[model samples]
Target: MSVWDSIVGQQAVVGQLQAIVSGDPKALAQSWLICGPPGSGRSNVARAFAAALESPDRGLSDEPTNITRQVLSGTHPDVTTLATNKVTIGIDDVRQLILTSEQMPSTAPWRIIIIEDVDRMLERTTNVLLKEIEEPSPHTIWLLCAPSAQDVLPTIRSRTRIVNLAVPSTKAVADYLMASVNPALPAERQFDRHVAVRAARLAEGHIGIAKLYASDTQVMSDRDELIVGLLGLRKASDAVLLADDLIDTAKSQAEADVNRQTAAAEADFRRINGLGEQDRIPPKLRGAYNAIAKKDEIKRRATRRSRDVLDRALNSAASIYRDIAVLQNNAEDAVGLINMENRTAIAELSARLSRQEVVDRLEAITVARKRLLGNGNPMLVFEALFCALIPGRL
Candidate 1:
């Protein structure tokens, strides 16, 4: 697809970028602060902009000399994209971009640099970038994507043009899904507009999760289990099981990552230092060495955050149950959960749990999330949390 066709429902962003690429992008439209909830089109917008800026001669191409395709493959000489993959984009990365931007593009129409998750950029790095943005090169355009404009520093926001992309309408999403799905599936196999809308709304503008729900029964079941587990009796067994599941997930990710890095580094080291009197120590081993050197912090953060993700799933379920508890009170009216299927247990809990008890437990779940982000103890926090939520054997 041409650059503009990729953004599903955002005509304005598409138009704005087209104009900019056609060399009439409004002078006022520098440094766009594209913000949206996670899974939204934030990164896509930045990518689209980069594609436009790096457009190769569309009508006439030299077989393989296309800048747009290059940018798409993440190999464009003049376009640099940074995301969470790099632990951090130091002042050096930004400074290098500044230097690259100053030099004329080797191939692309213009120099486009995309800083994804701009919020993750350290303050010092952000400061270094600000200098470049303040007086950017004529051929350079910086596209910054953040979860919220507020996520970027105040001073940084003040200097840039802001383009707020709204969540796609449900009708838009439903229509898009219809086009994306297979036609061979019977009409009865289709999702009604209502189901598509619910999935889209809950997804908060992420087409990926919306697609997951439509394509994977497992995803839907996972969501259901997550909600139900939270509201169910806080059994000691359930808490332990949940924590163990998370522990496995986190450990598996870390070990697999270490293994992949170790293998790649070892190969490169061996290739460079062939046979006689060569070094056996793989270069990639250096990274593993550094990681083990910081084992305390790495293990601490990963274990806690994984548990937090698990606990948050449980807490959401708990909230579902809590609402039902409130409902049994029947105070005037309640904003109810139409999706909540396990209402019987909710009603039973209402009779047993005091309002204060429900509220406090919810508060504890929130504390668990904070502690996880701050790198708290995984087992202790969740274990104690379960003890609080679960009724004790007196």
Candidate 2:
């Protein structure tokens, strides 16, 4: 129940950070870079470390405590967490982080700044804080998280201590999901041990995705539908249509997300400014408020949508190829299918397609992902991706 307890399958990392929290000089560092695959709890560890630094007893508790909760919720005065919902973390964002780094802690022993997705920063933006990261104040600490050290620039990478977290085993992920979160699910939504293990296997060691598949029937259905659509692929026209369909779906989901975020931001702004439900902003301040909402908040969400949608679609496409590869190699029993329930369709597809073709298709998916990240038009990128999935297509 201590801050470290929530981190799963990272005993080495936990032990190291715990030593630092306990004032072990040998374990302390001014800056740290924590790298892990998606859902490997990079941010969780960073925030937990922050909590440990701020807590009066240095997270010595054997029970869950409010200090960890406050840190996670972004209410702790001593901790500043920088997370971008945008496509990239810009210079302005890094400057803001730098500004906070200069400030001393209000009450805690250190002023801890945790930046999630440090890999998202532009090369120029990352360069701006080289000095600060290398030479922060004695009471300041920076905890940066990304998918890998390679994703970060060498300059920034060299300045920090590195902690790499491996993907946990399927059994480990399933056990945590079933034992911790699944039991608290409402009766109608609860998943049994069988379902939990299946979800964990399907998610391929991604804890967050495993939880989604276990708890949400609709997400599982969507995944099933996507897999079925992938297996049904035949020729050029179908691939094009499928690409259009996936892109359109992503756009719709992004629009819904944007609307939800906008509404929440407006509501928060009204509450802060003492405005009522029906109140209108005064003309003098209206322009400023509108600018903040449009340029800063909503704009960021739009960029995030582009990347998120593409990543999701790419992962879905990649899963099919991965299953195909397993089936083609006759390794079904040795390395079970990710789409386990679709074994029949997978076997049929394996019979129809060469293993090399499947590997080529996966390579195409990787190329398209890079193009999309490079700001290639998503429609064009997806069109190319789907067409490539059909071996004989343009």
- Candidate 1 has what TM-score? 0.67
**RMSD, each candidate, Å?**
7.8, 3.9
Model 1, residue 91: C-alpha shift (Å)? 2.9
Residue 170's lDDT within candidate 1 is: 54
- Top TM-score model: 2
Q: Report the CA-based lDDT of candidate 1 relative to the real structure.
A: 0.64
Per-residue alpha-carbon lDDT of candidate 2 for residues 261-284, written as tens digits (9 for 90 to 100): 777777887888889879999887
Report the alpha-carbon TM-score of model 2 versus the true structure.
0.83
Q: Score every model by TM-score.
A: 0.67, 0.83
Model 2, CA-based lDDT: 0.82
Model 1 pairs whose backbones collide: 230-318, 231-317, 231-318
Predictions in order: lDDT: 0.64, 0.82
Can you write out model 1's per-residue Cα lDDT over 1-394, one digit (the tens) per residue? 4755545567776776666666644553556678876666778778767766666543123343366677767887888886754445677777877787788777765677788888888898898888777777877778888888898999789888877777766556555665665343456556666666666544445676565455544445665665555456467888677555545644654454455555555565556656233455457555644554365755565554444345435544455545755575673154444344666766676677777777777777777777765657776666666556774421
